[model samples]
Target: MDTTYTGDVTPGGAPDVRELPHLRITKLAVDPQMSNNCYLLTCRSTGESVLVDAADDAAALLRLCDAALEGVVTTHQHWDHHRGLAEVVAATGATTYAGAPDADAISEQTGIAVDVRLQHGDRIVVGDQSLEVLAIAGHTPGSVALLYADPDGHAHLFTGDSLFPGGVGNTFGDEQAFATLVHEVETKVFDRLPDDTWFYPGHGNDGRLGDERPHLAEWRERGW
Candidate 1:
């Protein structure tokens, strides 16, 4: 990967294709391309935006902004999913937000100091847009998924590495903390989110709630 990388689609089955009103979601593929999914959410009314997972090229992320950069929300502290935190904030003066428990790690990367530290069930506001930060740990101690609504009231899940399109993220990387990822996904991430909300994984394509609903049983079998 170079300093200024371009975005693309993740591999595997066809990627999630959503057509939301007043909001556009672009799957900006980045390094370690398989499971790193980055997103851009732009408000139609204000031309302001919030970016999810600035783990890619800061320049590329900015180019994709196309609107004023309001903030960067990290789903977890993984380097591949968060390497651009400093560049993004420096470029836009945007605040840094993450699972409140991740404040230390986020602060270390951001250096502007963390403006907001959120826990599960907390929501951060950017313009009229409010993104509900759900603590979905396991893949990491502080992985979070931002659940927000589209204009028509449809919900979108920007799930980190906890869940994915066809399969779920591998928990072996966590060593002793593997259970955290599984429990967080089955209980925290999937428990509250409607079975109908669209699930976008950190490193893969999107899977609608309806489409991947059955996989929940399999995910639970692993004992979260």
Candidate 2:
């Protein structure tokens, strides 16, 4: 299991978790080049951490999180973002959490303990950090969006595939869900969360919620 990330993201040609995020993010460009984003929210003050969106080669991400990793948070149950969950839990021995309805979907994809099932209004307490679970199910029947905020008001969101920069999630479920996604992003995410919150999506690139807020609203108006 040479699960280390030895690709182009290395330093001196070596995998560099140091560069990943001395604080809370480790994006990996996986095989087939889907370039998904995973996260490790660490509170140096409390010495505890939580991982979100387990990518392929879990050991590598675990190595980046160190031993203080206490939990796993899947923004949603999508293949590219959660395929290595079993390896992550095995490496870190942390409890895994996801949307309540998507629990089985996540379990089937990642053979790890589903310690907690979250809902739209659910709050995840990890050390000193608190994350709110948003049910933005449009890309899939049970898609979820995870949002974290600090006491200082700094925020981070894992928008699975439900919301992206300049675009929303791709529809692959009941046709009505696409409409739901449209409304959800506007009323739930765009109107609810502040524009400055960092949004780490499941694919392509990462950005701020504010950066795409207008587009999200416009998309909804267009009936997309």
Candidate 3:
């Protein structure tokens, strides 16, 4: 298993792949304007794959899937996060999944209904592997992070726009929203996961939980 991947990607460029014992994680940057990140998780044993956040560039996303795509999990209802959702689902016939609170909005925005309304603690199967859904509501009512716990290694978290290297996602000055997001992230992520857990964000480079753990108090104090 290779752990050298940095999860750095550029729009219209090739994806950076990380191969694990039972799964392969491919991160790609799409949508030139938003620079959104898209992750594809392929189960090594079964060859089935699931995509997290079909951000944009349908053709590129399709090419990456290469006929092995099984489902698409939208992290939130944000326009940038699902710009290519409709096209990709149409082309691949992949099942759609999203947080229950954002399902209607996502469907309304993309014209594709969500096949599964995921809630906190919901489990999504990708071949022989599975991902746990963690609802971290703040940036959006249904923003969620996917947790992949590897038996042979540390955990992996895919935090859409909720948690990043420096702080949590933007809340548009809504103090309540920021507080809720911080609380959810603190309890569900920082508190539950180990320090070595690697997290892939929606936009930029990835980070480990241990690297970000010390700043929890600072993040809360600044309230971003």
Distance from true location, Cα of 137 in model 1, Å: 1.9
Q: Which is the leading candidate under lDDT?
A: 3
TM-score winner between 2 and 3, please give it.
3
Error at 161, model 1, angstroms: 1.4
Provide TM-scores for the models: 0.81, 0.82, 0.98
Q: Candidate 2 has which clashing residue pairs, if any?
A: 195-210
Worst 10 residues of 2 by lDDT: 10-19
For residues 22-55, write the lDDT of model 3, one tens digit per residue: 9999999997788999999999999899999998
lDDT score at residue 202, model 3, on the 0-100 scale: 93
Question: What is the per-residue lDDT of model 1 for residues 53-158, given as tens digits with 9 covering 90 to 100?
Answer: 8886777777777548788888777677778778888878887787767768867765646677778788877566777887866666777888876657657788
Which regions of candidate 3 deviate over 4 angstroms? none
Checking candidate 1 for backbone clashes, the offending pairs are 35-203, 36-203, 37-202, 100-118, 138-180, 138-181, 139-181, 182-224, 183-224
Model 1 residue 216 distance off true place after TM-score fit, in angstroms? 2.8
| Most accurate candidate by TM-score | 3
Cα lDDT listed for each candidate:
0.69, 0.69, 0.94
Global Cα lDDT for candidate 1: 0.69
Candidate 2 segments whose C-alpha is farther than 4 A from its true place = 1-23, 221-224
